[model samples]
Target: MINATILSMFSLSGLNDMTTKHRVTLFSFTLLCYCVILLVNSALIVTITLEEKLHEPMYIFLCNLCINSLYGTAAFYPKFLSDLLSNSHVISYTGCLLQVFVIYSYAATDFSILALMAYDRYVAICRPLEYHSVMTKHRVIWLVCFSRLVSLLCQAIVMIMTSKLELCGSHIEKLYCENWSILKLSCSSITINNIVGFIVIFFYFGHDLFIVCSYVQLVKSALKSREGRKKFTQTCLPHLLCLLNVTTALLFDLMYTRYGSASVPQSVKNFMAIQFLILPPLLNPIIYGLKLTQVRNSVLRLCRCRKQVKGLG
Candidate 1:
């Protein structure tokens, strides 16, 4: 087995699809999208932090969602934007692994946080009497931290397993670094890696199932009362949309990787590859910003406050 440590850099073949002439156009659009993501998520985060009324468990979890979106996107967008201009598309092996860790952990953390939010909602709706005792501010904070820690640990294990592989090559087929791409470069049998991958898959997908089941209970509890119905419509709808968006994006990527046709166009493949990274991060904040009444009102008030100050000045 060749020492995988001997491999230093890996070139990305995914960016080779489009002509160099179109890069500027693509870059501008991508930059705009990223800026919007930053703008919306930051606005939401600031609103949640400054407004004491928004300090409940649900809002705190939503704030964490926005913050995590920023955390996840930062790992990709900057490096991708750089590679957009540069002729060379290579990353150091260590850098590649680090990227895998960040990107994957971010994704895992996303599911974990969503599940936590679902639990928060379930408690609020289904167990209203016990909600105060169950989901204290400290408990929410602790759950947030615990979710990220578990995600990091899970991905850390994957990274370790991937890094130990005796890589046969350095050219990755994808636009960004990830486990499967690195696994493809391996010279050794990846049975253990594959096993760990399955375990992680089951682990995160468990989040989806938990959320769905929570919604089931929530709906049952909601149907009995008018106020419960209103709460479900306003709050749970956005959460469901977010879950669908993330789930769809992930399923697209997963299915394509596992069973997709080789002849499919690179553009489509690129979209599938980045669907989760781009859509959920961008959409989650927008969905929440618009759907949640309190947040919408706060943002409007915030805007008017800024306008008032400008007028006085």
Candidate 2:
């Protein structure tokens, strides 16, 4: 077995082509984007928590969604900003594995949460009278916990499998550490890793299929009544849009990871690498904030209260 201690750090070669000027510009934009994500997501979470009227199953799930966005972004931005300012773009082996766990778990949790949201909509729209009984407070908490826990378990297994591999290289061509990138460095047969990875992907693919099926039934039932149609447009539309946004962002990253050509511009490749990390966190809250009437009103009310407090001061 190759000694794991030999590969202490992995050089991130993706940033090598950037000049000092470009790095500073990229840093400024990234910082601004990260701040916006934090502000919007935190605002939504706080709004949902404080407003007793908004403490229903739908809003609670929305709160968890925002929290997941924040969790995912925290894994990327701090280290990314530090790297942009540093001379060497390298991450320690342990740190790389940790990043893989956090980032992938965040993504998996997102899918889990979205799937739950789809079910919530299904019950709320398809069985309005039974919705309260079906989505009770205890059940909501259990569902939320299940979403987070399953993701953590899956990603932890991936991380464990990756850590056991003896790496032969210390260079990662991407901007961030991912399981596949680390797997590429393995000196031994990665058949087991590949199998486990495929299993995880297929499991989450099942989540996507579930969401799609849920929506299919929802749309069919919703079209029968004007009231149902309005409810679907008011609430389900935002969820659908957010789902599309994240799905598209992830597709870009996956395509680039699998089929990216060296002949492609480094800037384009870098954008693809970070698109999922950027667009979903930034867009989810915005889509929900503008689309969900309850959330929109709560946010406005909170803002107005803040302004009144400042005036009183």
Candidate 3:
């Protein structure tokens, strides 16, 4: 009875007034931003991978982050683009299921990468003497693989558990497929799915936030030594800003959805949507590159080299 009531309340609360023009405009802009983010992140990843100078643990984590961002974009943007291009925003049952899985998978992967990056920074700053042995290339590879595996397994379990519930309708009112949106579609009770989704969110977002904060604090404390202070601040500031932006965006999203008035203005939702979707990925590379002189120079040199190569080849 409690579960049924919750589902009823959720169904009643979900917005169903998405207009074609609004969706087309919003999705077009999202796609454009997505394209730019993809290009920039991919360029960074490629430059890092190709340039022998960037083979350190930090750049390796960045390359993994780039891949995770692409994974996330792949999971959602195709459907978003299709929804805009076609008048029908209806995704087939299979497609929706796939979207849910991949979206969560990439989300989990991203959290793990960020956490690992925090740890990488902690080691690089806090234990410079031990950094080389602690963060070997082999260890980094294994860590990434382990992170991917954990994320994939978690997403798989969540997807499988949620798949047991039957979707009764085709009206998903949100911009894209989300776990809650699918749950709202279920004719049956969704308590289990909601609980599982909460758990997943807690671990992915909540725990990651905890770990990043703790690691960053450790990095800051360890930077008091004269030798490590400058390098530590130089590296930590950009990541700290990135984390702050991401955390703020995520926290606002949660609060708005959970506690904000039911009749939140469409304008507010649109602002939140842009903040949540377009901003983090867009800013990540810029922040990361700007913080690191080496990365900044590398990007400039790579651009110049590319132009010259284009001119020659």
Residue-level lDDT tens digits of model 2 in 1-313: 6644468889898888999999999999999999999999999999999999998998998899999999988989999999999999999989999998998898888888889999999999999999999999999999999999999999999899999988888889888898888888888889999899889978986888999999999999999999999999999999988888887887788767867898999888889888889998999999999998888999999999999999999
The global Cα lDDT (0 to 1) of model 2 is 0.90
Q: How do the residues 172-214 of candidate 1 rate in per-residue lDDT, one tens digit apiece? A: 8888987887887788799999999989989899899999899
Candidate 2 Cα RMSD after full superposition onto the native fold (Å): 1.4
Number of colliding residue pairs in each model: 0, 0, 0
lDDT of 1: 0.90
| Full-model lDDT for every candidate | 0.90, 0.90, 0.72
Off by over 4 Å in 1: 1-5
Query: Candidate 2 has which clashing residue pairs, if any?
Result: none
Worst lDDT window (10 residues) for model 2?
Answer: 1-10
What tens digits encode model 3's per-residue C-alpha lDDT throughout 191-281?
8877877787788787566666767677676657776777766877777776776667766765665456758776576466436455566
Q: What is the TM-score of each candidate against the true structure?
A: 0.97, 0.97, 0.86
